[model samples]
Target: MVYITEELVRRRAEHNECEIFSLEEVSLHQQDIEKIEHIDRWCRDLRILYLQNNLIPRIENLGRLKKLEYLNLALNNIEVIENLEGCESLQKLDLTVNFVGCLSSVESLQHNIHLRELFLVGNPCTEFEGYREYVVTSLPHLKCLDGTEITRSERIRAFQGLVEVKRRVWEQEKEYLRRRAKEKEEAHRKTTGEQERKGSKPGFDGRWYTDINNTVYVQCPGLEENKENQEAAENTKLKMTVPDLEEEQRREEEFWHTPCPFTPESRLEAHRHLEEKRKAKEKEEMKPKTPRTLITAEGRVMNVNEPKLEFSLTEDEENNAIVLDLAVYRHLDTSLIDVDVQPTYVRVQIKGKIFQIVLPAEVQPDSSSAQRSQTTGHLVLTMPRVEGEIKVTKGASRPARVCETGRSSSSEGQNRKGHVPERLEVDPSLHTAPDYANIVPRQRAKEGPLERARTPPAASSSSLSDGFEDDLDVPPLI
Candidate 1:
């Protein structure tokens, strides 16, 4: 029980500058001191303290010395680094040849961010692999570790090595948790089985038992005799009910044949009546035809006119896109055309006519573009295809479009009074041409006469009546 005392402090301070005993540094090495008590009361201004080679098992109670900058506890029995949180100005710490076994023992020093040098040689943690690297990496501001200055390359290697070490430690922790959970589940099952056994009623065979007073008792001795009596009574009851059961069965047959309410025929007739009524109601619902309408995002109703809009989807392998060609008989203001493209569908609205095409394959919406050809008056939309299959939703219900006459000029050679002219099938080969001619005006001038001849005729021309057809086969576009 060696304790630090006031007499000892005064005696130790005898060699100081003054007899008044105000010293900045104190050396109490090899003093056989096992406990440090009340040292701060006399040496409150201590800047350095050396208690090396003592029996102090823990570092504590030095927090009041706010200006403590250097502390050496080397060659002591200290096992943990703690209670120095108030030493805010501490910059150097030496704990060499101690019992510290893990890096966590020094973690309390992390709060002292200004610490620059650390010495922990001959400690149990020094035997670990990458011990110097671990300490240097953990305290990045530390310039010297174990009296050796840290290098740039060592810091880099420490950072890289810590990644693998942390991953391995994390995997080990996860497996430990899994094993603990399995152990808990097994323990719970055993507990439940024990409880079930305790709650169940005990079974009884023909057996004897002895009471506390040593009196003997027999259980279920007449079980076989009781079973024989029960069987004999059941046979007597069956003999008396035979004639009555046959009479009752005959009456039930007679009731089934009787017609009015309880007979099977009447139930069959009622079921047939309900089925006929259902069929008649379904037939009545199918008598009237209703026009299908679609509502736009702007809350406007548009009538679905069959055969009014015609479009085709052609795969342009040269352009790596799927081209959609729509015939527009009415002149459209190019600026008012609204096109919305999604992965699964494309919606195009020009004036009053709206066309929504659901694509069979997914497409990159950001790469899709719509252009109206000035030469043929056709709207061509190019969408670059993606990898996966696209899911298309059914079209929404649209409001009815109000009938307006002469709001816009019709295309040339189109009938003005009668039903709208049917759309003529255009040559699919026209889509395979290079898009530069339509997208860029400078490229159109470079087209030779042979290329110009291959261009499709304008929408106003009667090209379908020429009776000239190409041998190229075009698949139907949905």
Candidate 2:
């Protein structure tokens, strides 16, 4: 089948009932794609679109197609399953032979009531032996899966098998009921005859029955029943059963059978270490602590409760780059006042939900030593900046800022600021982030906030789609 162009798609749109299109076997590389910005635009009325063996990379192109019902994206380099946010009509999706490895990426597709079939055959995600079963259990509507179809014959066979099983169960239940009723009748007749012979009320044979049927009996000496007392009547019998003792012993043995993986020497060492640690922890709890909170990389509370802000700058020998390491204090509070940044004077601003750390040009370096001299060569480096600080929220619940400033650059191309005027000055052996890495060009001040308020606001439904522009500059812990 031929891949549609803008002209071809325009011609097809005029034709009514043209609901399906196939663009198979086309070597549609990223560079070859000139005008298909979002392929869904051309196939807005499409019910099925076969884009098999095409060189599609991302799923952002399919996010706008609200009418998509069936899609075949097999043999693509797709790694993520996204952009199908509101395609409610999508019933079947063929993602076989793709690079996808995670099924949780499309777990939200379970919300689609018509999503009955999903083909993920050649993908490693579906190849996991337990994954298919897990998906089936989680998504109840997933009937036909993994390039397989549920036909009418197959459904009928399953129904018939279930009916046969149910019939056998009912027969067994009926037979059990009949046997129990027959035994009850025989026992009633024997007891009535014995009572007539004695001409008195029913007497126990010095035995107690645990179950109502009296199939199993136990003998307990000094056990007497008082007809007049209701509580004694209920309490006269022993509550022990055969299964109870066995289950109790099984639990006890299981509790004690848990093995500890430690040698005798290791055990002694562990005991000593544990005792020392316990004393240290108690002393830490009793000591006067700092007023700082530590925020982890994932924005959670620090396990240890003592407060201490530690900072370090490490140099990487391989990449010739420096890394900023800041520790967050364990104490989290709402009244957290200042974040201490050593060897630098930076103004910290907390405006609403956003926190900004401004680094002046005086304290920061212009460029690393390697980039000022050579065009294409290797170089080694020493370390600098032994401390830094990162602003964290009260409970370390969120990272207010991130600082990934120190990095090395290898640029063989010209700089962006016009021509190289005069000096051939370049440092080929220094390590630093790209020259423009931390630089944000100063912008002119606009009108007051009240004056700009008259304009329409940005759509709340729209997300910040650009990845690099996301607030990733702040470090959560110091």
Candidate 3:
């Protein structure tokens, strides 16, 4: 084993141009050194020392280095951490790969208040239950452990885990003590019976009789020695089994008074009841639900009986097209409106009004186009008509508007001041139109009457116009 001599220390100090008195660091690692010597007396001002990777059995002879801030004794045979009480300035300690087997070994460094980083990886203590927690809780000032920064959550968990480990250990110890006491009691009973049989005397009638007063004297030739031995054994058995018996009785009472008892059938029944409840809930969820009606943001249900918006559907046989006119009175952002036109249904939702119209006949929805009039505020949807009869299927229940002349009733006309006799042209193709439902009128407009009479009356549908004049006063269509 190579030893660190004073001559070698002097030579190293000269080579590094460091004087012995002011030397701040020393590295004697991997020198096959078994013991640390002369360093405390020669280099008293040393601040950092590396004695790792050696066969050092224990940490010792470093108390004189009061200014030491860093110490690395890793990869050594350090079974316990002791003799570190004078390392007041130590900020980092590396004892990794060492044989620190117990928390008490780590507890020896609790006085190191300035220790900020510690490395105990590859140590035997790592195998202990709650070792990390024990170390962290024991050394509250440690900032980093085993190359990882200690966090608050880890600290809290460590404390709780340590408590649980200690509780389990205590319970195990109690059980072991109880078992030992029981074994000792059994052994003591056997010994006492053997002694009594050996101490028995034969009476004149040829029967063996144990005289309690002279039992010790009869068992052994030395009466006092045998009595003392018997008394000591009895005292030991009492000391061992008394507490165990009391603890057993207390535990039994606690169990007997417990409010709930654990049984497999009860647990199975509870699980089955929960499963049945879950299945019932699933079945209830699987039931069909009715479509929800639209409601305003202010909690008022949208009026389906009396719609706020009125629109007209006109079929042009000459052009083979269908025109839908929707009156838009409220100032609305066109970007907010969404319209979906299918072959069988047309859905329009703008602001608060939602309308879905089942078509009287199938139309080409892909070829449909919609345009908004800037001046009149009318949204017009034009769809190419297909050659087919109206299917007459049930549609969403909604207030309907119909005119005898088969013309659209204009909101502008109803609010007009002067009575203008206007004649509306009716399409002959629309005479066979089915009842149209599920239409919501737009908000009332503040505009004058539109020129509905501008278009010339068609000759094919004149009778429908005459019928409208004959029955001019018709109630609102339901």
Best by TM-score: 3
Per-prediction tally of clashes: 7, 21, 5
For candidate 1, report its TM-score.
0.34
In order, candidate lDDTs are: 0.67, 0.48, 0.69
The TM-score, computed over Cα atoms with residue i paired to residue i, of candidate 2 is 0.27
Clashes of 2: 21
Decreasing TM-score order of the candidates: 3, 1, 2
lDDT of 1 by residue, 309-401 (tens): 777888876766889898865466677677878777777766745677667677899998888888767888899988554536699866433
Better of 2 and 3 by TM-score: 3
**Candidate 3: deviation at residue 470, Å?**
99
TM-score, per-candidate, Cα-based: 0.34, 0.27, 0.35
Give candidate 1 regions above 4 Å deviation. 17-21, 166-478
Question: Candidate 1 at residue 284, lDDT?
Answer: 78
**Whole-model lDDT, model 1:** 0.67
User: Model 1, residue 230: what's the lDDT?
Assistant: 62
Best by lDDT: 3
